[model samples]
Structures are given as C-alpha cells and as structure tokens.
Target: MLVVWDSTVNIYSCAVEGQEGLHSPVVCFQVKVTPQQFSAYKTLTCSTTCTLTGNPTYIWYKNGQIVTDNTSPYSVLPNAVDSYSCAVKGQEYLHSPAVCVQGQSCNRVTYTKRRICVLKGSTVDMSCTVGYYSTTSTFWFRSDKSTPEDLTRDPGYTGRVKHTGTYKGPFILRISGLIEEDSAEYRFTFKTYNFEWGHSFPGTTLSVTGLQVKVTPAAEGQKTLTCSTTCTLTDNPTYIWYKNGQNVQDNSSPMYSISSEDADSYYCAVKGHNGLSSPAVYGPKTTVSVSPSGEIVEGSSVTLTCSSDANPPVQSYTWWYKKNGGDYQSMTGPHHVFNQIQSSDSGEYYCEAQNEMGTDWSRTINMDVKYDPKSTSVSVSPSGEIVEGSSVTLTCSSDANPPVDKYTWYKKNGASLTGSEKTYNFTTISSEDRGEYYCGAENKYGHLNSSSVSVDVQYDPKNTSVSVSPSGDIVEGSSVTLTCSSDANPPVDKYTWYFQNKTFQNGFGQMYNISKFKSKDNGHYHCEAWNGRGSMNSTALMISLPGKQTSVMNAAVGIIVVVLVLILCLSGLMWFRKKASKSTSDTRHTADNGQGDSSPVYDNISGMAMNPTAAQTAATDDQDDVHYASVHFSRAKYEEVPLYSNVQLPQPQKQDEDFQYAAVKFNLPSAAPK
Candidate 1:
C-alpha cells in the first residue's frame, strides 16, 4: 500500500562535489540528504564533503546523467523513487555516491548518509534500511565497479569485507583496511521469505584521497608553496588557498610565495571542493572585506571590491548574492557594480577571494526596497441560472500600492449599501435577494468600485392536489376526468396520472381524460404536477367501474357453499367416530362379563303351560347350555291352564356344580317407528 502524502510542496534535487584530488583532498563524492516537512511538500537535500578553494561550481546528476547544475544542499522531492549523483563540472570523472530513495511503503529503502569521505587505508562501515517483510538475508555489492558477490566470498573483498550483521538489517557492512579501489557505489540487497527485491537506489559512495605538499626555495629569502593530491586527478584544477584555518583572498594556482611567514596554518583544495583541505602547514592568515559596508537602498549604485592578505596576493574575486529567502547567485569579477536596483534585488551580498592556499568569504552586507496595489473587480461562483433556496457567494479582489484594507458591497439601482466585507454569502437565496450587485475595495492610496452582476431565482410547484370529476363511482364505459391542481409562480406545465393498478397512463395538461373506462380501470388514482423548476404529487382519488355488483354477489355465494360443505363434513366425522367407539366398547364389555349376553330368551306355548317347572316362565342354569325363546304370545289367546310337578336336578349336590353355566334368553325388542 502506498502512503498518502499530505499537502506540501517539496522538490528533491541536490548538488554534490567530486574532484580528482587535484588541489583538493581526494575523496569519494557523495550527497547526504535530510528530509524536511513543510505545509506544501516533503523534500530531501543532498550534501557532500569535498575540498575546494573559491566558490567552486557544482553539477547534479541523476542515474549518471546531468540533471541540474547547482551548489550544495540542493533539494529533491521524495514524491517517488529515484537515484542521484553529482560531480564537479571540470572533474566529471568523480561522481558523488548515488542514492535512491523510496517513500514509506512496502519494500521502501532509505539511506541515512548517501556518501562518505574517508582517508585511504582506513576502515569504514556502510549501512542502509533494507526493507523486507519476512526472513531476509542482506548482502553488499558495488555497481559496475564490482560484481554481485557476497563480500565474504568475493576474492577481492574476502576477509577484508566484514559482515557485522546477520540476515536482518538495517544491517551494516563493515570494511577493513579500505583501499582506493574500494571507492565505488555500494548498495545493499536482501531476500524476503517469499520473494527477492532489488532496485538501483540508495547506494553509498566512498571517496579516498591522500594529501601532500611540495615546498621550494625562492629568491630574496622567500619560499614558494604548492598543494597537490597523491593520485593524478582527471582535470588539472586550480588550487584553493587557505591560511590559519581560513580561506585566503587569492584563489588560483597551487603556488604560494612567502617572505617571512610563520606560526599559521595553510592548506589547499581543488575547485568545487571546499570541505577537505590539505594537511594544515604553519603559515600566515588573510582577512577579506568589501570596500563599502553596511546597508543600501533599492535602485542605488554601489561599488563592491574583495581584498585578502596571504603569502601571495589574492588572485581574483567572485561576488555572490544571497536573497533573504533564496539560494545564492554567483557573479565573477574583481569588483561588482549595480547600476540599478529593485526590491527583488534586496538581500545580503558578499564576495569570494582566492589564491594558491584556498578560498574564503567576506563579511555580508544588506539591501531593502518598496511597492503597492491598483485596480478592483468582483466575481461570483457557479455562474449560471440560480435556483431558489440554494446558497451563493460573491468574491471581491483588488490590487494596490500597499495592499487592500477592506471591501464593501452594494446593490445596483437600489442605492443601498449591502455589506462591508470582501465576500458576500447567502445561506438560502430567494427572489427578494436577486438584483444587480457590485463591490468596492479601499486601500491606503484610494478606493474603486466593481461592475454590477445579475441573478435569477426559480422555485417549484406547491400544494398540489388531485380531484375526480363527478366525484363518485361511474359504470364501465363512462367518461371520467382526473384534474391535478397546484399553486406555482409559472403554473404547472403538465400532470401525470397514476392508477392503483400500478400503471402509468400517458398524459399532459391539468385534466387526465379517461374515455370508456372499464373494469380493468377500477382503482384509486393520483396525479402529479410538473413545472420548469420542480414537481409535486397529489392525494389519491378513487374511481369505481361497472361489474362490481356481480362481484359482491359471487363472493357471497361462494361463502355460503363453503359453509354448508364444512358443516356436513364435520357431522359425518363425528358420527363415524361415535359409532365405532360404541361397538368396540360393547364387545369388550360382553367378553368381560363371562356369562355372555344378559338378554333374556323366552318360550311361549300355544296353550297354557303343562308343567310349570319344565316349561315355567323361568330362566334356568344347566350343564347342557340351553337357550330359551321369549314367550310373546298374548295372554288373552290362551285360556286353558295346566299344572306341572316340580322337577329338580337328579342330584342336588351335583346340580350346584352344573348350574355354573347360564342359559341365554332371547328377548324381543320394542317395535320400530313406522
């Protein structure tokens, strides 16, 4: 995921110095960048450590190509990822270490210091933030200057390339007994658990240089001095002279002459390198100054000159301008003349004097200037047809000598002052607020008025309602009208009718005419009023169609039939259940009795009974299991009566046991209903 940048204005560009150790101390070229956060943008600056005399020219390059020519502390926007390096124009062979910066994001890498200058034969460590998620192994390698080999295994770096960190980094790569060849673009690489990431960026450049001086005797008991580097540099750069730990006024050539110089330090550097000075040698000091010092006004003419005191007199001088809030501008000459000055030219001014020893700066001086504002105008936002109930704004502007003090607003033709502010705001606009409006601006010198502006306000239809003609249910094929009405400024343009059947009928005007309305059209209806500004919808109006009478009749008949069927079914179910339950219970009751059915069976003789005991109207128990028929003959039909002897069982004792079986008497039930 990419990180969102806040609103800030930051441009990333920088100038670093590189030299062939000519008059300058030989060292690797590198730009060290620092991030500064501002309201506008985020930026990175690249700085370098190089020894040079007078103001040396600087050239900035990106990925080995010249991008800009500027002095040290140049800025580059950290808006994206890019590699950069820099060099002295004349000594193009030496380039500062290149650095690539990636903003805060996945696999984002950044180096604290992009370049380092170390003396030859000294140990040094280079490090950077190698961003990786998982387990990662970091390795160090140089660009084309060296192969992509583990420093521990590469024959050249073996034993000398110290691995100070494991797989995890910000891991440091340490080098021991560094040689001149070690001066190259060093980058760090690493592998994540799932993938490998490598980009050409954020590489450290190392510069190695050794200082040496040649002294020779001159005539008249004087001595001549020359400052040089051990290695032969690319271009033969003029030497920069410095005395007693400060830059000398003379800045040119490696030779310096002294008659009685003692107890002061002296050094030299190549042009473009003012950082690494040769070993300090006992010598005299020099102080540089401008002829006329202190403040000056704009458009004023002034003469500025540079002077210095060294073993050899100052050779030349270069004037430089420093704006109050801007970068330095260089002008070469022994003396600088300003025929005319402007407010933009107001700031500090100084000069650079150079000799064989080194280069130095003079005390700074200051300048100032003045100006004001002139015309006025007004503007409106959203320039078009204005809608009622919407907000609107009018803004006023003016130019002046000193600046504008305040703004006033007014309504044209009305002759009334509206407000006393630069901007006129309307929270909710209405027709009354519309008119020709203008504004006036006043400053220290004078005041001016702006031209008039016009405004229009529009609104929508209001209080819309729907009504049906005849206001009652109409039979099929009858003509019906639905009219939409509302109160609006321009009147309703059209009316749209919607029916309860969920259908929209094509319509226009106020009245919706429905000719030959049928059953399908039987539903509630509503209409909408529309105008140029907006629209409004009305309440529903019900419309009745023919054939609704039969509908009620059919519905009632269906309900009646359904009720009858339900009643009949319920009765049948109850009857079946009751009959089944009674039959089952009767059978079970009879079986539980053990004596079988209790119904009696009687016998009726055509004449009177002959032996009452044998044919007595009685129920008897016997082993034969006999059954008797019911005596149902009418008593009136029988007249004669016979007497019978009492006949008991042959053995009374055995009779008790035989009586256990009971005789079944068949009885006649009552006659059925006719």
Candidate 2:
C-alpha cells in the first residue's frame, strides 16, 4: 500500500502492520520540476524520480529558501532572474536542482552586500545585480539626501567616482579617495522601456573611518601597538608603522611591539597608501614673524610669515588679525602679504598651523604703519537751505596715521581768522557769514587743505526801494520806468507794482514801464520784492506831474468866470418887464371906474419917451372906455444896439374907425456881459 504526506518532512520511513522487527528503509528521492525554461507567472509541477508511499505534498524553494508547501503544482509570479525549486514532504534536504525563471519581463534589483565599512582615503566598490524586461539606462546614486542624486555628478565625488557594467547586469560603482563625508547608503537604479525600479528598496550602506594606533601594556616593560579601524579593511590590506618620522615596519599583522620607556611619536598607514597616514601623538611648534624688521610706513610692502615644526608638515595655515579690541578676522595661507599697506593695516596678528595630528598657534605680533594726513574734506551739517538766524556747523575730516593734531579754519577772500578746532559752529548765522570756506588738517608728517565749500545764507528781501527813471519830475504824457530794488541772497524772484493800496501789475523782474505818463498816473507808487525766503514791500514813492500840468489848470479857471456874468445879466432884465406890466394894469382899472361905462377901450403906447405920469393922464382922458396896451419887443445882435417895441390898439367902439398903432424904444447895455 501507498501513503502520501506533506512536503515539510525531510525524511520518510514505513513499518508493516503485525510484522515483527520489520521496517521499510528510510528513503530520499530527488524532486523534478517540469518545464525547466518557463516564463514568469507560469504554473510548475513537481514530481519525484521514485514513487512515494502515500499522497505527498510539495514544498517550493526560491533562491535556496523555503517559500510555501503544496501538492504537485506550484503557482508563482517570479522575477526573471530568481531561482526556483521544489521538494517532497519530509524530504526538504534533498530538493530538485534550482531553475531560474526565464523571459517574461519583471523589474528587480539585488545588491551583493547589505552593509560595508572601510578606512577613509581608500577606494571602494559597490555592486548590484539587476533584472528587467528592456532596460534603457542604469546609474548609481547616494540615498543620504532627501532626493537621490547621482554620485558621479556630486561635486564632492567629482573625478573620484565612476560607473561600469551593462544596463541589466552586475553593475559596479567605484569611488577613489573616500572621505568621512562619503559615508552613506548607495543604491542602483535602472529605467526600462515603460518602468523604473522603485527607490524605496533598502540599498547597501557604507561607513568610512580613519585609522588609529592603540597601545596596550605587554610583557617585560614593552607595549604592543596595534593599528585599528572601525571595520575590517577590504582585501585584507597590510599595515605600515612609523616611528619619529621614519618607517619602521610593514607587514600583514597590525600589532607592533615597542619599549615602554621610549619617548618617541608613532603613527600608522595602510601599506599601499603612505600619504594618508594617521596623525602623530605629539604637537608641533609654531612661530610668526613679519617682513621689513624696521619701521613700517604707509604704501610700503609688508608680509607676515608663519613657521611650524610638525612631523607631517602643516597642511593648512590660517592668519588671524584683530584691531581696536575687535573680533579676529581669518586669512588663509603660509604668508599674508599687503602690497600697499595703509594706516588702517596696523593691528595685532597671529597664525595657526595645522596637520592631521594636531594644531599649533603662533605668538601675536603688532604692525604699525605711519602716514601723513589724506582725504581731507569739509562737511556742513543741515545740508540744504542754510537760512539766516539758524545754527550751522562745519566739520573738518581727514585720515592720518598719527592722527591730526591741529585744525585751522579759513574763509576765501576773508580778513578775519576762524577758530582752530575740528568744527566751526555759528550760533546765529547772518548774511555776512555766507562765503566759501576750507579747513587745514595737520599731522606729525604733513598737512593738507580741503576743498572750499560755500555757506550761502538765505534771507528775506532787504533794503527794498523803487526808483523812477529820469530822477526828478515825472512829466505828463512822457514815458517813465520804475525799477524795484532789493538785497537778497538768492536774488528777487518776483516784483509787484502797486499804486496807492491796489496792485496794478505783476512782474518777474525789477522794472515796470509805463508807455505814457498821464495826470492819472500821478499817485503814491511802491513795489514788492519776493524770493524763496520771504517778501518785503518797498517804501512808497510819490509820483507827481511836471510844470506842464499846472498851466492847464490856470486856463480852465478863466473860462469859468465869463459864464457866471452872462447868467446874472439875463436874470435882471426879466424882473424889470414884470414891473412895467403891473403898473399899466392899475392905471387901466382907475380909468374904467371913473367912466362907469364898462366898455372896453383901446390904447396905443410907443417909445419909452412917454413918462409914467403921461401914461396915466392919457388913460384918464379916455374915460369913455379905458384900454390896456400890450407891447412887443425885438431881439438885436450883440454888436448892434436896437431896442424897439411895437404896440397895436384894439378895434375902436365905432366899427368903421381905422386901427391905431404905437412904437416904443428902450436904452441897452453895451458889450453884452463879456
């Protein structure tokens, strides 16, 4: 009978029932996998060379490791390069020969080692195996940064890193002259036609360290010095020992025996790399000196040199300088030189000499450079618009090695001497203080004079007055020009002409012209001078007409006297005519009353020869009917004397009687009211 079991069992044996001391031999059979060159994700079947006892299970192995336990057929989605095998239950030790999955693309990477450690300054190689369907490119990068960067392009790895091998292959990354900063995880990445390998995969990690010599007590007053490293050196490199700057031993063993009483410095290095040796246990002696042992002057060449006595010689030198108790500034090199030294170059200086073993500092030295005064200048405070009555200050400045000891102030084309100090101040500035000024700066070596600067004092218009052209009298109908004058720092910008209390015209300059001077032009006239500072009105000047205007007034008065006499003569004549008419009316009334007839009577009167008594008698004699006479006068020429009057009588009481008329004459004044 046959029996089957799971593939987990490594060995198998059978015992027959009711058979005493009888057992089947423990057997092992080789498991064979069908389809040796199958594609990825293809199901595979496992069979044994010899038949098993019962229904048996199968165990699958990938890359020499157990993956799963199953019966007969096994299903897997495999990487194109991973190996696979199967085994029967209870016989895991005797499994089928491993077979790799072929064809059928998949993306995968496998590194040769997970972690590596090596000595600094030594070259290292990291390798990885890659699997892909169709690879386009592959590269190696460090995974230490937030983003993976190609090692070949890194500035720190320039000229020290290289990549080798094919796209889908056992790729190699070689780096020479490794440093402590090069310790990081490195990964290999490849790009296929459609996919890229994921960066999440943990890559190989590298740690770089320096070499050290450890001394321990040994037998018989001797000590064993061992060259030590943090990790085992690659390729099992030999060690080299140095004692007091001399090579002592070179061998595979890292241990060296030395006498305990020896007072010598010791160091170590790898056999092939002698330049990258360890630091010596002793310190170096250092000293600093300057060139030109005598007095240093400005613009002279000066240099500071640093010296050290070290086992491996100093690899780097740094010069430090301090001035006026300030912080030290560092400069690199064995010698610090100043091509043209200045007064500012004076300071205390020292140097530090360093090697791989230790560092040494030199004693401080003082440098002093003497020079004359230079860069002399004058500066004014309150830069713009120096107004009158405002305080102002003028400062003198210069650069000197021994410092300026004397300062003298001067004004161009001025007679008075100013103060002998760094600054010249004005308590209350005036227009008289405005002028070009300069200062003299003197030191122990020499003296310098600064360029002149102007102090323009701004003020309101002053001494403002108006002057008329032609000086004395302004004649009527003559052209006249009035000029406004004022004293100002910035000059007058505007001029305004005023007549009496009203502004007549605005002008940009001083002169105001009147084309025709008339009587109306005579008045109190003044002008206003204006500048940026202030405005001022000039004193009023009287503009009077000349003698030609006075004669015109006298002639006007004579014409007025003739007109008044003519008016008086005409008024007297009217009053005499009215009195004559009243006297005639009274006489007529008396005649009519004596007659008692009440009939109208006609009377004729002519020639002023008839006296008033005669005119009354004539009216009484005509008692039958008294009549009043009306007289008519005629006008005469001024040169002639004709004063005549005509009187006509009314119709007589008898209708057929002829009409009667009368003529009258009067005396007239001669030269009618000249």
Candidate 3:
C-alpha cells in the first residue's frame, strides 16, 4: 500500500488488493488510497476507516474543515493548497491520517500487475487505475496498437475482451481465449476532455506456452524427472503429472523421483492446463523380469520380459541368454520362453528394448527351474544275507532341484506297507520280514520311487516237524510217504528218517516212501534236519495196522474121509444078516456065484477078543476078495486105532518072507428069506 499526499491538488488514490470481506480490527485502524500517484487536474478522492463496523458513515475534512460526503472515496478537488483528513460522521475527534496531494495535472495510468503468464484458451484479467481530475474515458490495449484502441472494444478482440469494472472503472480488462499471439506488453490509456495520456513503459507483460519434460539419472536406483515450459508463465507454477496416461493427483511439484520399477511413460503439465500433458519420456533405464521365478526345478516353463519408457512407443525387443563362461545368445522378441526347461537351459538372461526414439538394455535376470527327484536308489545297511535277531537299516537317495523335502519308505511283499522316514530300521529281523523293499522321495514338484531290493534272512531251524500220510489202519497195497520240514533260514541241510527201533530207515531226502506196504513195515517213525548250525529232530509218527485179509485152504480134506466110513458099516450089517439066516434055516451051502478056485474066507466076529493095544480080524485065506467082510471093533481111543495088516500064513515061507496082513471079517447072519 502506498500513500501519496498531493498538497497541490489534495488528491488521494490507492493501488491495493480489494478488501471484499470485513476484517477484524485490532487496537488501531489503517487507511490507504488506490492509485496513490495522481495526475494534476484529476478528481481528488479521499477515504477513511476506523475500528468500527456496520458500514459506518464517514466525515471528510479538508484542511480542518468539514467535508460533506457519507460515502467512501469522497471526491473533492483542492481549490486551495490544503490538507484533508477524515473522522466518523458523529465522532469527529477520532481523526484519520491526512493526505495532501500535489503534483503536475495530467492524465495518467498505472498497471496493477507488472508481468504474468496464462494458459492458452483461458480467461485472464488485466487491471490498472487512472487518476485524472477530468479523466472521463479510459481503455486498455497492447503496446503496438494503432490509435491506442480500447482493448474492450477493439475489432480484433471483440468477442474475447470486455471491461469487468464499471464504465468509470479504474480499467479492468477481461480477455477470454488467450493465445500465444495475445502475449505482449499491454498499456492503459485515458482521455481527460482535452488531453489524452498513454502509459506503456511500465505495462504488464503476458506470456503463454505449452509444457515439456526432461529426465536425468541421479544415483543407481533413483531418477529425476522435471516438467517445464518454453518460458516461465507465472511466478510460482504448480505442476500435475501422469504415469502411463493416468493422472498422478498427489504430486504437485515439477520434478518427480523414480526407481527401476517405474518403467511406464510419464508426462506433466502446469496446473489449470486442462489436463494437457508434455510429450512422454522414459526414465533412467529399462528393467528385465522373468515369470515363474525363484528356485524352479528342471522341466518347468518360464517367461522373461523387457520393459522401458519411450517416446515413440517401444517398437522392438531382443532377448539375450548366457551360461556361465559361455557366449551370449540372442533372440528377437519381448518374451523369452522356456518350455520344459532342462539343466542345460540354466543361464543368465537379459533383454534390450528399442524404438525409433531410443534403445535401452535391461539388467540380467536369472531363472531357476524346479523338478521332481531322479536317479533314485535304495540301499541296505549290511547289504547281504541278514541274520535273524540282528539290526538292519535301509536308506533312500535321490537327486533334485530345490532338494527333496520328504522321503517315504515301503516294505513290499505282494502289497505295499508305508512308513514316513528316509531310513527304515529293524531292531531284530525275523523270517516273516524277509521280502522286497523300496522308498519314495518327494518335493513340491513331484514324486519318484527307488528300485526295490530283496532281503534274505539266515536263521537256525526251530520247531522241526514230520508228517505221515495214510496214517492209521491203512488198507493193504497202498503207497505211503513221510515228509520232514522245519522253519529255518538258509534252509534245512539234511533230512534223516527213523523207525521205532531207533534205526535210520531212510537217508536220501525229506520223504520216506513205503510202496506195497506190509505188516512188518508198520512202526513208529520220525525225521531230523541236520545242518551246519545244529541238528534238530522232529516229533514221531506211526503206521499202525494192516489193511485187509488175503487167502483160504484146508476144508477139502475133511469131506473125503466121511464118505469111506459109511460104506464099511453097510457091509458089516449085511454080512451079519446072512450069517444068521444060515443058522436058522437048513444049511444051504452058500453057493459062490461063480466062485474062484481059492476059497474065500469068512471071519467070525463073535469070538474075537479085544486087546487094548490091538483088535484085528485075520484073513484065513490069502484071497478074501470074493467074500464081503466087515469087521467091527469097540475101540478105546487110548488103544491103537484099527490096524490093517497084510499077512501070509506059513505056506508062503517057501515063496517069500510073508507080508503080514490083518484083515478080519465077521460073517453075516441070514434073516428069514423074505
């Protein structure tokens, strides 16, 4: 605020910011003038303020005399060289500072602003104040204006410019649709009836321009990007920015800090630019990244990408791969893909991005591939025949990337039995546990199984046993076998069979065969297993009885003897009847029917005496063949049973030594001839 006391004209003017709102006054009150510098013969104005409100009416005094205006800016000209002061209408003792204006009388103007910049296609206000005793008309125009045309009514700026302040305005020129052509020093002009004035030397300078961006690298990880214009538009211009064409509303500074992750195109503009942005610019460098990253095993796929910020948009990308101590390989694409990657594909990889504007190379990236375990194997602790009641351990092994996290053990017979540790252990091995065994190794990727290994348990025989078929009361003529067996490792070496007499019955093998069995073969039997360790005998077995009977002979001899005895008894009875008949009747000579020359002898059994030792009937003649004779003897079983002897009487002494004969006949008694 400026105070110009012109004692010559007693005029006051102020060039100050408008105080539209009421201010809270402290202990004291202040007053000022607008357009403090004034030309001579201009209308003099005076104003006053105090520590009071309600739009208080003011009392004006010129050189200690009461002035008559209730409104502010009481216009008055100093008819004489005097001073002016102010006080409240009723409270005149509370006086204000006096302003004594004195200067050369002339039409004059002063711009409120010296220089400014505005955005294109926006509205702007240019203001100034003119102080002249008779300044009835005033206008604004640029410095090169012809005839100093009024900016508000000029033909070239007709629809775009107007006076915001009233017709008597300390001129405020409002212009819309500002353009670069509108940027220049603007002056204010005023006409005071006869004299005209133009003030251009201290006019306000206007500037209009678009935005631009620049990038620079500060440190390894940080980059600095600044947004600027062709020329400075305003004293303090706040900036707005965009990343990948998205507004960054939080950033209000022209410069921004960036890192490797911020690879997108960036642009900025001044505030109130209607979202206009500078041409996009890439920051410090490109960045390279691989997908499916981190400790991947072999046989998996991976993708790599190269990214950067560029002006003309990235046009081409090239991928480079290299192994340890090997040459780099190049492939043209934005991505490098590894499908079913293998160990030979492991290496360092990088990429380059190029455009019509520029080119950049990204930092190297490493891709590791993970896979399931392989080359799996299982091993036993002692590796050979296992002894019973001895400890054994089985270990599983495999190769994997991202090393295997789990191992499972299984014992295999016909089926699988599972356990959770890498090693399976047995405190004491038994015959029941001998079989094929294997293990499975696993990780996040997959699972693999080890090859199976078999175990052979060596043990001494226990609980030896022997068994016999067709055991008891077997039928004859059936074959039988006795088998010997035992529970043992390395098998039983020798099998021996024995009988009840404690003699070795069979020696060749485990079985004793008895084919076409006989009674002598039936007996108690047992077997034994003989080996290097020790020998064990089995429980006894037996074949008890014969099966069936076979043959029959002596009944035929008894039947033949019965028939001969009956014929002899009949002959004796007949002879007896014949003898009796002869005694009772006249002695009829027993005529021999065709008798032979040798007389047949008839024996008389009535006179026969019995000897306990021998009872005999003698044949009187050598031939008794013609006579039927029967001899009956009551015999004691204690005596010699009937003896028949052939006898020749003493007549034959001359022919031969007589064969002795004992044939005696009893003559039959004849009954009456009926």
**Model 1 — which ten-residue stretch has the worst lDDT?**
1-10
What 10-residue stretch in candidate 3 is worst by lDDT? Answer: 635-644
Ranking 1 against 2 by TM-score, winner: 2
- Residue-wise C-alpha lDDT for candidate 2, range 502-535, written one tens digit per residue: 8984544689888899887777788999997899
TM-score of 2: 0.39
Error of 2 at 89 (Å): 83
Cα TM-score per model: 0.25, 0.39, 0.33
lDDT of each: 0.58, 0.70, 0.61
Report how far off residue 360 is in candidate 1 (Å): 5.0
Off by over 4 Å in 1: 1-328, 331-369, 374-387, 390-393, 397-402, 410-418, 435-440, 445-458, 461-674
**lDDT-based ranking:** 2, 3, 1
Candidate 3, residues 553-648: lDDT per residue as tens digits? 123343444334436644654463454444422222222233232222222334453231111212222123323333334311121112112222
Best-to-worst order by TM-score is: 2, 3, 1
The candidate maximizing lDDT is 2
Evaluation by lDDT, superior candidate among 2 and 3: 2
